[model samples]
Target chain A: MLKLDNIKTYYGNIQALKGISLEVKKGEIICLIGANGAGKSTTLMSISGIEPPRSGSIFLEGIDITGMPAHQIVTMGLSQVPEGRRIFPQLSVLENLDMGAYLRRDKEEQKRDLEYVFDLFPILSQRRNQSGGTLSGGEQQMLAISRALMAKPRILLMDEPSLGLAPIIVQQIFGIITRINKEQGTTIFLVEQNANQALKIADRGYVLQNGMIVKSDTSSALMADEEVKNAYLGV
Target chain B: MKYFLQLVLAGLTKGSIYALIALGYTMVYGIIKLINFAHGEIYMIGAFTALIVGGALQITTGLSPLTILAISLAAAIFFSSGYGVTMEKIAYKPLRNAPRLTALISAIGMSLILQNYVLLAQTSDFLPFRSMIPNFPFLTPGKSLVTTTQLVILITTVVVMVILTLLIKFTRTGKAMRATSQDKVMAQLVGIDINKVITFTFAVGSATAAIGGVLIANHTGQINFYIGFLAGIKAFVAAVLGGIGSIPGAVLGSLVLGMTESFGAGYISSAYEDVFAFIILILILIFKPSGLLGRNEIEKV
Candidate 1:
């Protein structure tokens, strides 16, 4: 489980996230939906320690982890698949996966996790020798997710995994996300602009508007709510 | 014909040394995206380390050439790598997050400080290394031909280049290094210690350059406090000539520059030797821009 209390983040003079807070329960898929510049990505980044909150406390399993370095947070079982699918271009797919388990000292566990990634994304296994950059956008996204999964984090944070994918691929990715949550019991904190699709599978959801959480409810409740539908789904 | 062959042989020997030194520039630039100006001084430091160690251990000049070379190389790699790591920690690491220009100026400053440190200690005098390593004039039987020192330089350079190429292409650490060079943040996310990878790069580059410095001292029979400046500049020009970040390109560039200087000095005049290398550099920049083998990197906005 993770908690963000009164989180404030800034990019120099501009306040990106102003006093936003949310809680993600263990083994649950929670999506933070918002329009452009709603600080969805900033919230994920703040939790991952890439951009620590300016004035907030972030807790993982009741332990304060605010202001920890990105790598240290990763060691503590927190992994972020950054917004742009920032895969190491020069590395082969296999090398990128190897990097994900960088902190793991157990070679056998690394091997097992690599197998798990291959199972989750079979395309990655087929193109294990291909350069990370040469993969198609959808495949690259898959690799990025698989790479983060290689870290075997208890909680996975994904930013805009479906941003550039086709609808079919997005559906396939979401199906995989559901399976991952069910099978691995990995808690998922995802940020997205696609509200209708995100809310469908999310156990619980939060709607962010201009850096503040505007609504929170069960997935079906938010899906059926008139205001949530009008504001986020455009129905 | 024999005389010409002899000259060509001599050119290759010297060319190989330039190639070795040029690799240092190329490798550091490949990963860090900064031209390590202090790379040349690493060579200088290696030579001094060899000098001190050889003297302190009482490994006299009369020993077998192989033994002397082995001892000098070990000492050179050890000391130069230590100096390189220290330099990175003190001078480079602090400026890493700063603008690239700031890091570049810091490198130049480090180079100056290193040169001054040597100047204070060694007084800028040319110290002669022994000339017993045979200048085997095999091609020009009975005439002054390229020495064994030059032959060793050529052989050593080739061996080092081949090994480096293998290391970069085949090894996990080498892959990690290339990954870091391509994207530092991404490399870290995957579990690489970016600092350690960078330090390893510096150490490898410095170690190679150290070998070159010792060979240069042996062949030329003189070492000076300020010798690294000219050699470093030429090697840098070589790195740029072959494409700044390309390894094989640096070697090819060094060969071209070396041949140009040697032939120009012979056919024209020694006075214009420096001028010839500079002019060639300018022409390469104007015409190719990416050097002989450098691929143009396209940046998407």
Candidate 2:
């Protein structure tokens, strides 16, 4: 489980997340849906320590990890499949996965996790030797998620994994996310612009607008709410 | 034909040194995205350290040429790595968050400081290799035998390149280094210690330049305090000529530049040798901005 208590983050003079607070429970898929510049990514970044919250605290598994370096946070079982699927382009698909488990000490466990990842994304296994840059956008997204899974982290944070993929691939990726949650018991905090698909699988969901969390509810409640439907679902 | 053979010999020796030095430039630029102008000064410091240890201490033993060569290489690697790690920690790391220009200016400042520091210590006079280590012939061809120095230069350069290539290609640390270079954010996200990788990059580069400095000293038989500037510019040219951040490109560029200069001086005009090197650089930039072995990088918006 993770908790962000009154987190504030900024880029130079502009505030990106203004005292936003949220909680994600263990083995749950919690999606934050928002329009452009709605602080969804910022929230994820704050938790992952890529963008340290200017104020307040973040707790992972009841331990305060506020302001720790990104790499340290990763070693503490928090991993992010960053925006734009920023996989190492020059590296082979296998090498990219190895990078995800950079902090692991157990070589046998690493091999086992690698096998699990390859099973989750068989395309990555088939193209293990292919350069990451050569992969299609959907494959790259798969590699990105599979890479995060390689860490065997307690929680996985994904930023817009479906941003530019085709609808079918998006569905496939979403399905994998559900399976990963169910099988590995990996808590997922997904930030997405596709409100409908995100809410479908997300047990709990939050709506963000202009650096503020406008709504937070169980996925069904958020779906049935008229305001959430009109504002985000375009009903 | 004999003259051509000699030119090739000299070119190969000089080319190898240039390749070693240029590797420093290319490696640093590859990871940090900024030119560490003071890298040449690190080389100079290495040569000076060798001079002090070999000259002042008389540490040279007349065993085999191989032993002396190994000791010299070790000394150079040690001194240059020290200076490089210190320089990165003090000068580069502070400006890492600043703009690229700030780091560049700091590098220039460090270069000047290093030059002045050597000038003050060793004085402006060019120094020779300490006489304790008598020259032994390593390359002999009937009447013309290449000095142990030239052989050492070629051998060391190749050795450094091989070690670096292996380090970058196959090692876990090397993989971390490549990842860090590709994307620092993602690298950090994956638990790579970016600072440590950057420091290791600096160490590797400086170590290569150290070997280059010792070889240059032994081959040319003299080194002034300000030698780093000319060598730095030439190595930078080689780096750019080979395709800015490519390792093999640096080696290839160095060979081309060295051969161009050697043959140019031998057949064309000695005074115009530097001009020829720059001309080739300009031509390469104009025709193919990415050197011979460099791949074009595509940026997505």
Candidate 3:
């Protein structure tokens, strides 16, 4: 479980996250949806400790993690699959995967996780020895997600996995997201601009507007809401 | 042909020394994007340490020449590595998020501080360094093209190069270093303590520079507090020439620069050797600023 309480974050004098409060129970896929610059990524970044909130506190399984460094947060079993799939360009695919499990010293567990990721994306295994920069966008995305999975974290935070992806690939990625949750029983906190796809898979969703949470409800209720449909669903 | 062979041998010997020093520059620059202007002073400190240790051993004990040199070399690595890590911690670590210009100014300041510290602690005059390498029959001073010192320099360089390549390509910490250099944010997401990686890089790079400092002191048989200045500048040029962020590029640049100086001074006017080195740099930067093997675009440090 993860929780945020009235967190405020700033970039110099300008406030990007005015005051955000939300929570996700264990083993559930929770998504935060908003338009561009509505603070979706900022929220995730705050939780990940890359952009720490200036005020309020964040908790992971009731452990306060405010003001923690990014690496420390990761060691606490929190992993982030950041936007743009920033795979180390010059490193081979296998090397990138190796970096994901950087903290894990147990050889057997790392190998098992490696095999699991390879099974999730067979193309990645095919391009195992090739440099990550040489991979296609779809393969890169898959690698990015698989890299996060390789961390074997108890909770995973993903930002805009469907961005710039084709509709079919988005569907495939979303299916895998659902599958990863069901099979691994890992808790996921996803941030997305694609409200339609995100709501389809999320159990509960929150709508962020200008760094404030405007609405929070179950996915079905949000899907039927008139304002939500017109503003974000684009129907 | 004899003269030519001698010149080639001399150039390679000089180039190998430059390569060792330039590696420190390239490795430091690769990780933090800081030019580490103090790197030259670290080399200077290394040489000073070897001189002190080597001289002290001569007076204090009846050690063999090889044994004294080995002890001096170890002391150089220890002191140089310590200074390097301390310099980063004191000067550069706090400025991790500061502007590039700020960090660079800090580096220059650190360099000046170390230079002055040595100038005050040790005499600024050139100190005589006894060449401790055991002379071999085949490597007799006038009998072979390569002197004993030159042969050791070349062989030591090759061995160091081979080990460094293997470490970066195969070792876990080395892989983590490459990963950290590539993406700091993602590296953290994977739970790598970046500060530790940075400290390790400084230690290794400084150790290599220390080896260079000691070797060059042995080869030249003389040293001063200011020796690091010219050597550091030349090595910096070598790093930039080969591509500041690339490893092999530093070695290539050092060799090319060494040959240019050697052949230029050998055949052309010897007085303008420094001028010739700069001319080559200007031409290469004009044509391909990314450097011979560089992948990143030009961002002068």
Candidate 4:
């Protein structure tokens, strides 16, 4: 499990997250639904150590990982598929995936993970030698997720995987996310603007508004809540 | 025909050195988008290190020429790479989050500091670089001749290029480097130590520049503190001409620049050789702003 204790993050003098706290239990799909500038990405970034919180601590299992360097956080079994599928445009698909497992020394396990990734996204295998930039948006997103999976992470932090994708593609990606959580037993902390799709797949959900968490409940309850429906789901 | 062959051979010899130095520029530019003006100083230091190590070995020990050459080359590479890494840590790392112009100004400052340090440490006058290779007969029996040293430079450059290409293509560290160059944050999220990769790039680039300094000094038989300035400028021009961040582009640009200078001097006038090189660069830039091998990447919204 991962826990954040009253974390406060800032961008220079401007506060981004004001005493935000959240929890992601093991093997659960937890989604954070918020509008633009709601500090969803900021929360994930603070946890991932890209932008460390100015105040309070983050814990993975029982270990304090507050203010650790980003690379070290990844080694501690956390990985992120950033908002934009920031794949190396010049590198071949295989090389990009290879970079995902950069810290792992176990060759056999790496090979197995690579095979699993290829199987999960067959398009990646087909275009294994092509440059990542040349891929379609959906394909690039798939490659990004597959690349993150190559790390064999205990927790995968995905920021807007459904952003800028077609509805069908979004459905497919969400299905994959669901399968990943149920079958692989990997904990996921998903941040999404698509509340309808996200809440459907998530076991639990939290609503963030203006750098603060306003609601947290079971996904079904959040879906049924009149305010949640009006504000987010547009139901 | 023989004269043409001689010009081509000489051009290749000079081109190989430019290519070596240009690789350093391109690699650093690719990773951090810094021009690294101090890179030339690293080359000068490399030549100095080789000179000191080779001279000391000759005076203190009775070693074979080949052994001395190996030892001196290794020392130069090691020392120059260390200087490269140090320069990055002290001058560039602090300014990583600052504006790009700040880094550029810092690079120019670093260059001045390195040049002055070398001038104070070693004499500003040109120092002779003794040939390490044993004498060998010319490949051709005509006026247009190929010496053993020219052959050595060409062969060494080719071998190094091949090895570098392989390193960037097949290695895990290379993949990490490519990843870092593409997106530093994503690379970190994937558990790559960005600082380590950047340092490795600087070290490898400096090592190549070191070898270039050693070979070029040996070829010309003289080196000075200010030699790196002109050579570095020419190599920078080559890197830009080839597409600043592309590896093969750097080599291509160097060869083209070298051939232009050689042919210009041979057919026209030696005094206008540098002009010829710059003319080619300007022409290339005018026509293809991205350089010969560089792709104009479209920004995805």
Candidate 5:
């Protein structure tokens, strides 16, 4: 579970998130849909401590984690699959996954986690020895998601996981995300511009526009809303 | 042929020292993107630490020469790593978020401060470094060959190189370091303390420089406060020549630079040895830009 109350974030003098508030319950796949530069990524970054909120507080499982360093935030069981799949280009696939579990010390647990990840994405196991840069776009996205899962976080925050992905690949990724939430019982806070697909899988959704949450409702309700359909779904 | 073999041997001996020092430059540069001009001073401090420790051990204990050498080398590495970590904490860490020029100027400033500190603490005069290993010079057909010191330097360098390669490839800390170097923010998101990795880089890099300082001081039998200045510049050039952020590139560049200087001095003119080294560097830069083993990374827009 995570909660942000009246969070404000900035890039130098320019404000990105102005008094935005949101919440996600445990084991729920909550989607935040917004146009480009609509504070979606900024919200995820604020939670991850990459861009600390200038005002307001963020609570993860009732514990305030607003101003903690990014590394500390990760150790506290929060993981972010950042935009553009920032996998280490030079590192091998296995090394990239190893880095995901960097905070863990138990070798047996790490070995089990590695096996679990490989099972989830068999392509990753096949290309375990290859450099990350050599992987295709779909494979790279899988690696990025798999790398975050290697952290075994209580909640996974993903930013634009579907960005630039092919249509069929996007479907496959979304299916995996659904399975990860259902089977693993992992809470997901996903930010996406692919409103149609996101709304299809999400239990609840929020609409963001120019650094503000314009609408919040259950996925079916938002899908049936005329304004939401016109603006986000392009239907 | 004998003369050529002697020059190659001499080049290798000197190159080993340069490669050791240049590794420090490449690694610190790779992680932090700072030249760390103060690194040379770390080497100078390492030599001084070894000298003092070796002298104290001789006077205070009746230890064997081998034991004394090992103890002094360890002390030198420990102290040099300390100096390096402290320098990063005091001089470079604050400038992490600052502009690149600020860090560069700070590194030069730290270098000067360290040099002056040594001058005030130790004498400016050249200090004699006793040969820890006994001389066992084996002659060749044309009266050209290797000494025990040269053999020791080569073997030690190779061993250190292998160990370093293994450490970087097989160890978790090394993997964290490589991750941080590639993507600092991403590394942090994955629970790696970037500060710890950076600190480790400085510590390990400084340790290698310490080994180089001790070996070179032993071989040359003299060390002055300014010794690090020229050596530092040469090592920097070697790093740049090999591609500033690539480890293998640094080693290869140092060997090439060392061999060039050795052959130039032997076959051409000893007076212009440094000139030959610089000329090679210039030629390499003009032609390759990226060092021999360096990858030319295209910036993603």
Candidate 6:
């Protein structure tokens, strides 16, 4: 389980997140959906400790992880696939994935995880030696997610996984996300601008507006809500 | 034909030193994007450490020349690596988020501080450096164009280069370093300690620079506090000429600069040897600013 309590984050003088609170129970796919600059990414970043919240706390599995350094946070089995994928452009796809399990010492387990990720995205295996930058947008996105999965995370925090991908590719990625959650029992905290697809995969969802949560409900209810339908679902 | 071959051999000997020192500049620049002006001082310190350690061992102990050489080389690497890590911590780490110009100024300041510290520690006069390597019995001067020292220096350089390539390509830490150089935040996302990686980079760079310092002292048979200044500047030029962030570029640039200086001095006039290096550098800058092996910055879609 993951919990955020009144977390506020800022970039210099400008506040990007203002006293936001949310939670996700164990093994659930939870999504935070909002438009651009609505602080959805900031929320995940704060939890991941890339940008620590100025106030309040984040707890993962009942342990306070607020304001921890990103590297240390990763050791606690929390991995973030950051916005834009941020894959090492020169590193081969396999090397990029190797970076995900950088802290693990279990060679056999790491090999298993590598196989799991390659199986999840078979296209990645074919391009294992190709540099990450050479991969297409969809392949890169898949690489990014697979790279996170290589960490063997208990909670995977993904930001904008579907951004700039073809609709078919986006659909395929979402289906994989659902499969990853169900099969591995991995808790996912997904942040997205595509509310419709996010809500469809998410067991529960929150509508984030301008650094604050405006609504939280079962994904199906949020999908049908009048305001949510008009604003985010493009109804 | 003999004269030209001799010149090429001389060029390779000089290039061996340049490539070693240039690697420090290129590796540090690759990860942190700082010119690390103080890198030269680390080289100077390496030579001094070797001098002090070797001199003391010769005086107080009856160790064989080979043993003395090994100990002195290790000491040089240890002390130089220490200085490098300390320089990063004291001069650069706090300024990690500061403007790059600020870090560069700090580096320059660190350079001055190191040079002065060494000057105060040891006299400014050139100290004689007895060759670390014993004479090779098989090498006859007239029969072989290369001297024992030059041959040793070349072989050592090749060995070092081969080891470095293996380190950068195969090791886990090496992979982490490559990842960090490419994207620091993403490296952290995967649980790599960025500070540790930065410190490791400084250590590895200084280690190579230390090897250069020891080998150059062995070859030239002399040392001075200010020797690192011109050598550092030349290596920096070589790094830029080869593309500042590329590893192979540094070696290639060093060799190119060395051959130019060697042939230009040998054939034309020795007085303008240094000038040839600068002319080649300027040409490279004017023509291919990225250096031979450097990748142009291509934005991802």
Query: How well is each residue in B160-254 modelled by candidate 5, as lDDT tens digits?
Result: 99999999989999999899989998998999889999999999999999999988888898898888887888888888888999999999989
Docking class of 1: acceptable
What is the lDDT, from 0 to 100, of the residue A33 in candidate 5? 98
Compute the lDDT of residue B53 as modeled in candidate 6. 98
TM-score of 5: 0.97
Q: List the TM values for chain B, per candidate.
A: 0.93, 0.93, 0.97, 0.96, 0.95, 0.98
Q: Where's the lowest-lDDT run of ten residues in candidate 2 chain B?
A: B130-139
* Higher-scoring candidate on DockQ, 1 or 6: 6
Order of quality (DockQ):
6, 4, 2, 5, 3, 1
lDDT of 2 at B94: 86
lDDT of 3 by residue, A6-87 (tens): 9999998999998999999999999999999999988988998888999999999999999998889998889988988888
Residue A8 lDDT in model 5? 96
- lDDT by residue for model 6 over B49-95, one digit each (tens)? 99999999988999998899999999999999999999999999999
The superposed Cα distance between candidate 5 and the true structure at residue A187, in angstroms, equals 0.2
TM-score of 6: 0.98
Give the clashing residue pairs of candidate 5, or none: none
Backbone clash total for model 5 is: 0
lDDT of each: 0.85, 0.87, 0.91, 0.91, 0.91, 0.92
- In model 6 chain A, the worst 10-residue window by lDDT is A41-50
| Residues B100-211, model 1: lDDT tens digits | 9998999999999999999898778887765434445463535546556776788889899999999987777887788788777777666677788889988998899999
Give me the candidate number with maximum DockQ: 6
What is candidate 2's lDDT per residue for B169-235, written digit by digit as tens? 9989999989998999899989998999999999989998998887787677788898888888888
Summarize candidate 5's per-residue lDDT along A129-188 as a digit string, tens digits: 999888888888999999999899989999988888899999999999999999889999
For model 3, how does the per-residue alpha-carbon lDDT over B143-219 read when each residue is reduced to its tens digit?
67788889899999999999999999998899889998988988888888899999999999999999999999999
